[model samples]
Target chain A: MIQAALTFAVTCFALALVFNLWHLARAPGVVDRILALDTMVINAIALLNLYGISQGTPVYFEVSMLIAMVGFVSTVAYCRFILRGNIIE
Target chain B: MLEDTTLIAEIVVSVLLVVAGVFGLVGSLGLVKLDDTMRRLHAPTKATTLGIGGVLIASMIYSAVFLDRLSFHELLITVFLFLTAPITANFIAKSYMHRHVDEGDLPPTEGPYGWAVYDAVPEDERPIDTK
Candidate 1:
Protein backbone atom coordinates (compact mmCIF):
# COMPACT_ATOMS: atom_id res chain seq x y z
CA MET A 1 0.00 0.00 0.00
CA ILE A 2 2.73 2.42 0.98
CA GLN A 3 4.71 1.54 -2.11
CA ALA A 4 1.79 2.23 -4.39
CA ALA A 5 1.03 5.52 -2.69
CA LEU A 6 4.66 6.58 -2.87
CA THR A 7 4.86 5.64 -6.51
CA PHE A 8 1.84 7.75 -7.34
CA ALA A 9 3.24 10.75 -5.53
CA VAL A 10 6.64 10.37 -7.16
CA THR A 11 5.16 10.02 -10.61
CA CYS A 12 2.97 13.07 -10.17
CA PHE A 13 5.80 15.23 -8.87
CA ALA A 14 8.11 14.09 -11.65
CA LEU A 15 5.55 15.02 -14.26
CA ALA A 16 5.06 18.37 -12.59
CA LEU A 17 8.82 18.97 -12.70
CA VAL A 18 9.00 18.22 -16.37
CA PHE A 19 6.17 20.61 -16.98
CA ASN A 20 7.87 23.19 -14.80
CA LEU A 21 11.06 23.01 -16.84
CA TRP A 22 9.04 23.41 -19.96
CA HIS A 23 7.44 26.47 -18.41
CA LEU A 24 10.84 27.85 -17.60
CA ALA A 25 11.81 27.46 -21.21
CA ARG A 26 8.79 29.43 -22.32
CA ALA A 27 9.28 32.11 -19.67
CA PRO A 28 11.41 34.90 -21.09
CA GLY A 29 12.51 36.56 -17.90
CA VAL A 30 14.99 35.15 -15.39
CA VAL A 31 12.63 35.81 -12.51
CA ASP A 32 9.90 33.61 -13.94
CA ARG A 33 12.35 30.79 -14.54
CA ILE A 34 13.81 31.09 -11.06
CA LEU A 35 10.40 30.98 -9.48
CA ALA A 36 9.48 27.90 -11.46
CA LEU A 37 12.74 26.28 -10.47
CA ASP A 38 12.08 26.96 -6.81
CA THR A 39 8.69 25.31 -7.06
CA MET A 40 10.32 22.33 -8.72
CA VAL A 41 12.72 21.87 -5.86
CA ILE A 42 9.91 22.01 -3.33
CA ASN A 43 7.89 19.37 -5.17
CA ALA A 44 10.93 17.15 -5.46
CA ILE A 45 11.60 17.38 -1.73
CA ALA A 46 8.09 16.41 -0.77
CA LEU A 47 8.22 13.47 -3.15
CA LEU A 48 11.63 12.55 -1.81
CA ASN A 49 10.30 12.12 1.70
CA LEU A 50 7.43 9.98 0.50
CA TYR A 51 9.85 7.77 -1.41
CA GLY A 52 12.07 7.53 1.62
CA ILE A 53 9.37 6.22 3.89
CA SER A 54 8.11 3.75 1.35
CA GLN A 55 11.57 2.26 1.03
CA GLY A 56 12.01 2.09 4.80
CA THR A 57 15.13 4.23 4.80
CA PRO A 58 15.92 7.27 6.88
CA VAL A 59 18.67 8.58 4.61
CA TYR A 60 16.25 10.22 2.20
CA PHE A 61 15.07 12.45 4.99
CA GLU A 62 18.61 13.76 5.44
CA VAL A 63 18.91 14.28 1.71
CA SER A 64 15.62 16.12 1.65
CA MET A 65 16.76 18.36 4.49
CA LEU A 66 20.04 19.09 2.77
CA ILE A 67 18.26 19.86 -0.47
CA ALA A 68 15.92 22.22 1.30
CA MET A 69 18.83 24.06 2.90
CA VAL A 70 20.94 24.25 -0.25
CA GLY A 71 17.98 25.20 -2.39
CA PHE A 72 17.04 28.04 -0.06
CA VAL A 73 20.60 29.37 0.02
CA SER A 74 20.92 29.28 -3.75
CA THR A 75 17.60 31.04 -4.22
CA VAL A 76 18.76 33.76 -1.86
CA ALA A 77 22.02 34.10 -3.76
CA TYR A 78 20.14 34.40 -7.02
CA CYS A 79 17.90 37.03 -5.50
CA ARG A 80 20.95 39.04 -4.43
CA PHE A 81 22.40 38.87 -7.90
CA ILE A 82 19.13 39.86 -9.50
CA LEU A 83 18.74 42.77 -7.12
CA ARG A 84 22.33 44.02 -6.93
CA GLY A 85 23.93 42.54 -10.04
CA ASN A 86 26.38 40.73 -7.78
CA ILE A 87 25.93 37.89 -5.33
CA ILE A 88 28.91 38.82 -3.25
CA GLU A 89 31.51 41.56 -2.95
CA MET B 1 -8.26 -5.85 17.16
CA LEU B 2 -7.70 -2.42 15.58
CA GLU B 3 -6.83 -3.60 12.07
CA ASP B 4 -10.00 -2.32 10.40
CA THR B 5 -9.59 1.07 12.03
CA THR B 6 -6.07 1.42 10.67
CA LEU B 7 -7.26 0.59 7.18
CA ILE B 8 -9.88 3.27 7.41
CA ALA B 9 -7.29 5.81 8.50
CA GLU B 10 -4.98 4.81 5.66
CA ILE B 11 -7.71 5.26 3.09
CA VAL B 12 -8.44 8.75 4.30
CA VAL B 13 -4.79 9.80 4.22
CA SER B 14 -4.06 8.25 0.86
CA VAL B 15 -6.94 10.21 -0.63
CA LEU B 16 -5.44 13.38 0.74
CA LEU B 17 -2.06 12.59 -0.83
CA VAL B 18 -3.67 12.00 -4.19
CA VAL B 19 -5.50 15.30 -3.99
CA ALA B 20 -2.26 17.08 -3.17
CA GLY B 21 -0.61 15.62 -6.25
CA VAL B 22 -3.44 16.86 -8.43
CA PHE B 23 -3.12 20.37 -7.06
CA GLY B 24 0.60 20.35 -7.79
CA LEU B 25 -0.07 19.28 -11.35
CA VAL B 26 -2.49 22.11 -11.90
CA GLY B 27 -0.01 24.60 -10.49
CA SER B 28 2.73 23.37 -12.81
CA LEU B 29 0.35 23.79 -15.73
CA GLY B 30 -0.30 27.37 -14.71
CA LEU B 31 3.40 28.08 -14.70
CA VAL B 32 3.56 27.21 -18.38
CA LYS B 33 0.52 29.19 -19.47
CA LEU B 34 0.84 32.39 -17.48
CA ASP B 35 1.71 35.49 -19.49
CA ASP B 36 4.15 37.19 -17.15
CA THR B 37 6.51 36.66 -14.25
CA MET B 38 4.22 38.30 -11.72
CA ARG B 39 1.34 36.13 -12.83
CA ARG B 40 3.43 32.97 -12.82
CA LEU B 41 4.48 33.59 -9.24
CA HIS B 42 0.93 33.08 -8.06
CA ALA B 43 0.64 29.58 -9.51
CA PRO B 44 3.52 27.95 -7.62
CA THR B 45 2.66 29.70 -4.39
CA LYS B 46 -0.83 28.28 -4.48
CA ALA B 47 0.30 24.78 -5.45
CA THR B 48 3.44 24.55 -3.36
CA THR B 49 1.58 25.78 -0.31
CA LEU B 50 -1.81 24.06 -0.46
CA GLY B 51 -0.71 21.13 -2.56
CA ILE B 52 2.41 20.34 -0.60
CA GLY B 53 0.40 21.03 2.52
CA GLY B 54 -1.90 18.12 1.72
CA VAL B 55 1.03 15.82 1.16
CA LEU B 56 2.41 16.68 4.57
CA ILE B 57 -0.90 15.87 6.18
CA ALA B 58 -0.72 12.52 4.48
CA SER B 59 2.79 12.02 5.79
CA MET B 60 1.69 12.76 9.33
CA ILE B 61 -1.05 10.19 8.95
CA TYR B 62 1.19 7.47 7.55
CA SER B 63 3.81 7.96 10.22
CA ALA B 64 1.25 7.96 12.93
CA VAL B 65 -0.29 4.74 11.66
CA PHE B 66 2.76 2.70 10.70
CA LEU B 67 5.20 3.85 13.31
CA ASP B 68 2.62 4.23 16.08
CA ARG B 69 3.56 7.82 16.73
CA LEU B 70 3.25 11.29 15.34
CA SER B 71 6.01 11.87 12.84
CA PHE B 72 6.81 15.55 12.85
CA HIS B 73 9.76 15.64 10.48
CA GLU B 74 7.35 16.20 7.65
CA LEU B 75 5.85 19.09 9.53
CA LEU B 76 9.24 20.71 9.91
CA ILE B 77 9.91 20.45 6.19
CA THR B 78 6.47 21.80 5.37
CA VAL B 79 6.96 24.75 7.68
CA PHE B 80 10.39 25.43 6.29
CA LEU B 81 9.12 25.21 2.73
CA PHE B 82 6.26 27.59 3.38
CA LEU B 83 8.54 30.12 5.04
CA THR B 84 11.36 30.04 2.48
CA ALA B 85 9.47 29.95 -0.82
CA PRO B 86 7.63 33.20 -0.19
CA ILE B 87 10.78 35.00 0.90
CA THR B 88 12.52 33.75 -2.19
CA ALA B 89 9.64 34.90 -4.34
CA ASN B 90 9.71 38.33 -2.75
CA PHE B 91 13.46 38.66 -3.23
CA ILE B 92 13.24 37.52 -6.81
CA ALA B 93 10.46 40.01 -7.50
CA LYS B 94 12.46 42.80 -5.88
CA SER B 95 15.47 41.88 -7.95
CA TYR B 96 13.38 41.78 -11.09
CA MET B 97 11.96 45.17 -10.34
CA HIS B 98 15.40 46.54 -9.59
CA ARG B 99 17.02 45.18 -12.74
CA HIS B 100 14.32 45.45 -15.36
CA VAL B 101 12.43 48.52 -14.20
CA ASP B 102 15.44 50.86 -14.16
CA GLU B 103 15.75 53.80 -11.81
CA GLY B 104 13.60 56.25 -13.70
CA ASP B 105 11.46 53.47 -15.05
CA LEU B 106 9.70 52.77 -11.75
CA PRO B 107 6.75 54.76 -10.57
CA PRO B 108 7.59 56.33 -7.21
CA THR B 109 6.96 53.75 -4.49
CA GLU B 110 5.32 55.63 -1.71
CA GLY B 111 3.30 54.49 1.36
CA PRO B 112 4.66 51.74 3.64
CA TYR B 113 6.80 49.95 1.06
CA GLY B 114 9.51 52.64 0.83
CA TRP B 115 10.95 50.66 -2.07
CA ALA B 116 11.63 53.91 -3.84
CA VAL B 117 13.63 55.09 -0.85
CA TYR B 118 15.76 51.97 -0.88
CA ASP B 119 16.14 52.05 -4.63
CA ALA B 120 17.42 55.62 -4.43
CA VAL B 121 20.52 54.76 -2.33
CA PRO B 122 23.72 53.18 -3.60
CA GLU B 123 23.95 49.47 -2.82
CA ASP B 124 26.68 49.61 -0.20
CA GLU B 125 24.91 52.25 1.86
CA ARG B 126 21.36 50.92 1.54
CA PRO B 127 21.79 48.18 4.14
CA ILE B 128 23.15 50.58 6.74
CA ASP B 129 20.61 53.23 5.83
CA THR B 130 17.81 50.94 6.96
CA LYS B 131 18.94 51.24 10.56
Candidate 2:
Protein backbone atom coordinates (compact mmCIF):
# COMPACT_ATOMS: atom_id res chain seq x y z
CA MET A 1 0.00 0.00 0.00
CA ILE A 2 2.74 2.39 0.95
CA GLN A 3 4.64 1.58 -2.21
CA ALA A 4 1.57 2.31 -4.22
CA ALA A 5 1.28 5.68 -2.61
CA LEU A 6 4.90 6.42 -3.31
CA THR A 7 4.50 5.51 -6.94
CA PHE A 8 1.51 7.77 -7.27
CA ALA A 9 3.40 10.65 -5.71
CA VAL A 10 6.34 10.16 -8.03
CA THR A 11 4.13 10.14 -11.04
CA CYS A 12 2.57 13.40 -9.95
CA PHE A 13 5.96 14.95 -9.53
CA ALA A 14 6.74 14.09 -13.10
CA LEU A 15 3.51 15.65 -14.23
CA ALA A 16 4.34 18.84 -12.37
CA LEU A 17 7.68 18.95 -14.11
CA VAL A 18 6.01 18.73 -17.47
CA PHE A 19 3.59 21.55 -16.66
CA ASN A 20 6.34 23.75 -15.26
CA LEU A 21 8.23 23.25 -18.47
CA TRP A 22 5.20 24.44 -20.35
CA HIS A 23 4.98 27.58 -18.27
CA LEU A 24 8.62 28.29 -18.93
CA ALA A 25 8.05 27.94 -22.62
CA ARG A 26 4.94 30.08 -22.95
CA ALA A 27 4.57 32.55 -20.09
CA PRO A 28 5.38 36.18 -20.67
CA GLY A 29 6.74 38.73 -18.20
CA VAL A 30 9.09 38.37 -15.27
CA VAL A 31 6.34 38.38 -12.68
CA ASP A 32 4.66 35.43 -14.37
CA ARG A 33 7.96 33.61 -14.65
CA ILE A 34 8.72 34.20 -11.00
CA LEU A 35 5.30 32.94 -10.06
CA ALA A 36 6.00 29.75 -11.97
CA LEU A 37 9.32 29.40 -10.20
CA ASP A 38 7.59 29.70 -6.87
CA THR A 39 5.32 26.82 -7.82
CA MET A 40 8.39 24.76 -8.66
CA VAL A 41 9.79 25.32 -5.20
CA ILE A 42 6.58 24.22 -3.56
CA ASN A 43 6.26 21.13 -5.73
CA ALA A 44 9.86 20.23 -5.08
CA ILE A 45 9.30 20.29 -1.34
CA ALA A 46 6.28 18.05 -1.67
CA LEU A 47 8.32 15.67 -3.78
CA LEU A 48 10.95 15.57 -1.08
CA ASN A 49 8.41 14.49 1.49
CA LEU A 50 7.24 11.66 -0.74
CA TYR A 51 10.87 10.69 -1.20
CA GLY A 52 11.34 10.51 2.55
CA ILE A 53 8.46 8.10 2.83
CA SER A 54 9.65 5.92 -0.05
CA GLN A 55 12.98 5.53 1.69
CA GLY A 56 11.35 5.01 5.09
CA THR A 57 13.69 7.61 6.48
CA PRO A 58 12.77 10.48 8.79
CA VAL A 59 15.58 12.61 7.42
CA TYR A 60 13.62 13.56 4.31
CA PHE A 61 10.85 15.04 6.41
CA GLU A 62 13.26 17.51 7.92
CA VAL A 63 14.55 18.27 4.47
CA SER A 64 11.02 18.88 3.25
CA MET A 65 10.43 21.32 6.08
CA LEU A 66 13.61 23.13 5.25
CA ILE A 67 12.71 23.31 1.60
CA ALA A 68 9.33 24.76 2.43
CA MET A 69 10.85 27.41 4.63
CA VAL A 70 13.52 28.34 2.16
CA GLY A 71 11.11 28.47 -0.74
CA PHE A 72 8.78 30.82 1.11
CA VAL A 73 11.52 33.09 2.36
CA SER A 74 13.16 33.30 -1.01
CA THR A 75 9.88 34.13 -2.71
CA VAL A 76 9.30 36.89 -0.17
CA ALA A 77 12.75 38.25 -0.75
CA TYR A 78 12.38 38.13 -4.48
CA CYS A 79 8.97 39.76 -4.42
CA ARG A 80 10.35 42.51 -2.25
CA PHE A 81 13.12 43.04 -4.73
CA ILE A 82 10.69 43.20 -7.60
CA LEU A 83 8.65 45.80 -5.81
CA ARG A 84 11.47 47.95 -4.46
CA GLY A 85 13.88 47.62 -7.34
CA ASN A 86 16.58 46.58 -4.89
CA ILE A 87 17.15 43.76 -2.43
CA ILE A 88 18.72 46.21 -0.02
CA GLU A 89 17.79 49.83 0.34
CA MET B 1 -6.03 -6.15 12.62
CA LEU B 2 -5.35 -2.43 12.41
CA GLU B 3 -2.66 -3.17 9.83
CA ASP B 4 -5.21 -3.89 7.15
CA THR B 5 -7.01 -0.65 7.77
CA THR B 6 -3.76 1.24 7.69
CA LEU B 7 -2.87 -0.27 4.38
CA ILE B 8 -6.15 0.80 2.87
CA ALA B 9 -5.67 4.31 4.18
CA GLU B 10 -2.21 4.47 2.76
CA ILE B 11 -3.42 3.53 -0.66
CA VAL B 12 -6.07 6.21 -0.62
CA VAL B 13 -3.68 8.87 0.57
CA SER B 14 -1.12 7.94 -2.04
CA VAL B 15 -3.72 8.40 -4.73
CA LEU B 16 -4.44 11.85 -3.41
CA LEU B 17 -0.76 12.73 -3.47
CA VAL B 18 -0.45 11.71 -7.09
CA VAL B 19 -3.36 13.92 -8.02
CA ALA B 20 -1.77 16.82 -6.19
CA GLY B 21 1.51 16.38 -8.02
CA VAL B 22 -0.32 16.46 -11.30
CA PHE B 23 -1.96 19.74 -10.38
CA GLY B 24 1.34 21.22 -9.24
CA LEU B 25 3.09 20.32 -12.45
CA VAL B 26 0.29 21.66 -14.58
CA GLY B 27 0.28 24.93 -12.66
CA SER B 28 4.01 25.30 -12.98
CA LEU B 29 3.82 24.80 -16.72
CA GLY B 30 0.99 27.26 -17.00
CA LEU B 31 3.03 29.80 -15.13
CA VAL B 32 5.97 29.33 -17.44
CA LYS B 33 4.07 29.04 -20.68
CA LEU B 34 1.49 31.77 -20.30
CA ASP B 35 2.06 35.09 -21.92
CA ASP B 36 1.81 38.22 -19.76
CA THR B 37 2.25 38.28 -16.02
CA MET B 38 -1.45 38.46 -15.37
CA ARG B 39 -2.15 35.29 -17.32
CA ARG B 40 0.77 33.49 -15.72
CA LEU B 41 -0.36 34.30 -12.20
CA HIS B 42 -3.41 32.11 -12.60
CA ALA B 43 -1.38 28.93 -13.11
CA PRO B 44 0.40 28.99 -9.76
CA THR B 45 -2.72 30.14 -8.01
CA LYS B 46 -4.63 27.09 -9.09
CA ALA B 47 -2.20 24.21 -9.60
CA THR B 48 0.83 24.80 -7.39
CA THR B 49 -1.14 25.67 -4.29
CA LEU B 50 -3.38 22.67 -4.54
CA GLY B 51 -0.75 20.37 -5.97
CA ILE B 52 1.78 20.92 -3.18
CA GLY B 53 -1.08 20.55 -0.81
CA GLY B 54 -1.86 17.11 -2.17
CA VAL B 55 1.74 16.00 -1.69
CA LEU B 56 1.73 17.25 1.89
CA ILE B 57 -1.33 15.19 2.67
CA ALA B 58 0.37 12.11 1.28
CA SER B 59 3.38 12.71 3.50
CA MET B 60 1.15 13.06 6.48
CA ILE B 61 -0.49 9.76 5.69
CA TYR B 62 2.82 8.00 5.19
CA SER B 63 4.14 9.26 8.52
CA ALA B 64 0.99 8.25 10.30
CA VAL B 65 0.95 4.77 8.80
CA PHE B 66 4.51 3.58 9.34
CA LEU B 67 5.46 5.60 12.39
CA ASP B 68 2.06 4.92 13.91
CA ARG B 69 1.94 8.49 15.03
CA LEU B 70 -0.06 11.56 14.22
CA SER B 71 1.78 14.16 12.20
CA PHE B 72 0.70 17.71 11.46
CA HIS B 73 3.87 19.40 10.34
CA GLU B 74 3.21 19.25 6.62
CA LEU B 75 -0.28 20.55 7.15
CA LEU B 76 0.97 23.68 8.81
CA ILE B 77 3.38 24.43 6.00
CA THR B 78 0.74 23.89 3.36
CA VAL B 79 -1.53 26.41 5.00
CA PHE B 80 1.27 28.90 5.22
CA LEU B 81 2.27 28.40 1.61
CA PHE B 82 -1.23 28.81 0.20
CA LEU B 83 -1.63 32.02 2.11
CA THR B 84 1.68 33.48 1.07
CA ALA B 85 2.11 32.57 -2.62
CA PRO B 86 -0.84 34.58 -3.85
CA ILE B 87 -0.01 37.61 -1.75
CA THR B 88 3.49 37.64 -3.15
CA ALA B 89 2.21 37.39 -6.71
CA ASN B 90 -0.26 40.17 -6.14
CA PHE B 91 2.39 42.42 -4.65
CA ILE B 92 4.77 41.91 -7.51
CA ALA B 93 2.14 42.57 -10.14
CA LYS B 94 0.80 45.61 -8.37
CA SER B 95 4.26 47.10 -7.96
CA TYR B 96 5.16 46.47 -11.57
CA MET B 97 1.99 48.18 -12.72
CA HIS B 98 2.58 51.04 -10.36
CA ARG B 99 6.02 51.73 -11.70
CA HIS B 100 5.11 51.51 -15.35
CA VAL B 101 1.91 53.54 -15.26
CA ASP B 102 3.34 56.42 -13.26
CA GLU B 103 6.07 57.05 -15.79
CA GLY B 104 3.66 56.70 -18.68
CA ASP B 105 5.94 53.90 -19.88
CA LEU B 106 2.82 51.93 -20.64
CA PRO B 107 -0.50 53.34 -21.60
CA PRO B 108 -3.13 53.07 -18.92
CA THR B 109 -4.88 50.53 -21.09
CA GLU B 110 -1.78 48.61 -22.05
CA GLY B 111 -1.79 46.18 -19.13
CA PRO B 112 -4.27 43.35 -19.18
CA TYR B 113 -7.51 44.30 -17.44
CA GLY B 114 -6.43 47.87 -17.95
CA TRP B 115 -4.37 48.25 -14.82
CA ALA B 116 -3.71 51.79 -13.64
CA VAL B 117 -1.73 50.89 -10.57
CA TYR B 118 1.18 52.71 -12.17
CA ASP B 119 -0.59 55.86 -11.11
CA ALA B 120 0.69 55.08 -7.62
CA VAL B 121 4.30 55.21 -8.75
CA PRO B 122 6.59 58.20 -8.54
CA GLU B 123 6.90 60.05 -11.81
CA ASP B 124 10.64 59.87 -12.38
CA GLU B 125 11.24 56.22 -11.62
CA ARG B 126 8.18 54.72 -13.28
CA PRO B 127 9.37 51.80 -15.36
CA ILE B 128 8.49 50.95 -18.87
CA ASP B 129 8.37 47.37 -20.07
CA THR B 130 11.11 47.77 -22.61
CA LYS B 131 10.90 44.16 -23.59
Candidate 1 positional error at B49, Å: 2.5
True contacts kept of 1: 0.61
What are the candidates' interface root-mean-square deviations?
A: 1.9, 2.4
DockQ of each: 0.64, 0.58
* Residues B1-131 of candidate 1: C-alpha lDDT, one tens digit per residue: 59997888778777887788888888888888778777778888777667787887787787778777676777887788888878887887786777576666567667434465253555565556564
Which regions of candidate 1 are displaced past 4 Å? A1-4, B102-108, B111-131
DockQ-derived CAPRI band for the predicted complex in model 1: medium
Docking quality tier of model 2: medium
True-contact fraction for model 2? 0.72
- For every candidate, what share of the true interface contacts is present? 0.61, 0.72
CA lDDT, candidate 2, residue A13: 76
